[model samples]
Target: MTHELGHAVHEYVSKKYGELGREKSCAQAETASIFAEQLVFAALLKAETDSKHRFILLAKHIEEMIAKTYRQIAFYRFEDMAHIERTNGEVSAQRLQEMFKSVMDNYLGPSVDTTGVEFICAGIHHFFEYDYYVYSYCFSCCVVNSLYEVYKSGTVANFAEKCMDMLTDSGVENYCSALAKFGIDATSPTFWQDGMRLFEQELSELETLEADIMKRTYINLEKKATH
Candidate 1:
């Protein structure tokens, strides 16, 4: 519901662009949705005082971000591998499964069993048809997280206004142009570096909070046992 509202807000802001506005890149299409959800998430995180509740919210948000960003990009690997195989001949279904399992193991790590990766990969229609489209999720995740960091850091003045301006120009501009006003170069390697840094920061906060919560729990249990 909240996610869809993000899309709706984007549509409303971009409607004036007419056909041009409606025709956006897949990554740009997802940016607003992720941005809006993160806005809501940040707000909820600020108000929550309970450690256990905060952990759950933080964990869920981080996990979903990973699934949306890393997992989706991992899926994009399948598209790349399949296309290369197509140069010689049609890739067999079994071969596609092999490629998917291989990629899955790389991302999921060696400890986890990926026994039926084929069945999981089969559920994604884009696996066979979309070519190289899944990268949009990764693209959006990076852009939104970077933009969110800017908002959090106060690096840019009047950011909300700038963000609104960018969204308004959605029909007329690509992400590179849209982000230029903020001094954000979507083409630069630093763009990805900044994004990963934000992710690492979030993960560090989660780790800190988890440690504090566990220590408090231990203290409480010790006090009760002594009593």
Candidate 2:
């Protein structure tokens, strides 16, 4: 929907014919891919009967998705800035390693071990292929955030239908118009904030479940000791 519809409409409308709109279509396509993955993850959680594993799966998926998206976007932005600072100067392997390490530390926080993934910097195709394009992952989430809010608010009737249309019409339409249907302005920070808030909500749910499990485990251990 996002790819073909939202973007296609924007490109076609913005361009009048929408022959071969590249950036808008590509961005929308990328966003739709991630959104579809999220929908599948959500469906799995809903279908699962086991309450114990549901939150665990939810937590793991949330962490993995957010970490990958945020860190990769940050890496792209960092590389862009680094290149700008260096101008036409060449990028050394050590420089790339240092930059990758800095962002990994920022995103992984104190929870995960980064040593195992140090070599990952060498494999990032975006760092070489697309200058500063990796941040589109972050932008994709921002666009999805506002769209999901519109979905949840029930303000836009036939939203899914519109999305389906947009998908089929994939082109170089103005995203502003596409999102305006839902009263969203992608230029505003509020649009992205909605997505971040959703991410945080998932984190909170995970933490609460972890706390409950730890409490129960402590009680069980104490009972065994007493016996």
lDDT of 1: 0.84
lDDT of 1 by residue, 1-227 (tens): 77788788878888887876677666777888888988999999999998888888889988988988778878988778878988999888899889988888888898999899766878887655665668887888889988998898888999998887787777778779889878789899999878777678778888988999999999999999999
Where is model 1 more than 4 Å wrong at Cα?
none
Model 2: per-residue lDDT, tens digit, 27-79? 66656666665666677877986646977797777766575477767787668
Number of the top TM-score candidate: 1
Q: Show where candidate 2 strays beyond 4 Å.
A: 1-25, 109-118, 222-227
Model 1 TM-score on a 0 to 1 scale: 0.92
lDDT score at residue 113, model 1, on the 0-100 scale: 90
State the lDDT at 129 in candidate 2: 79
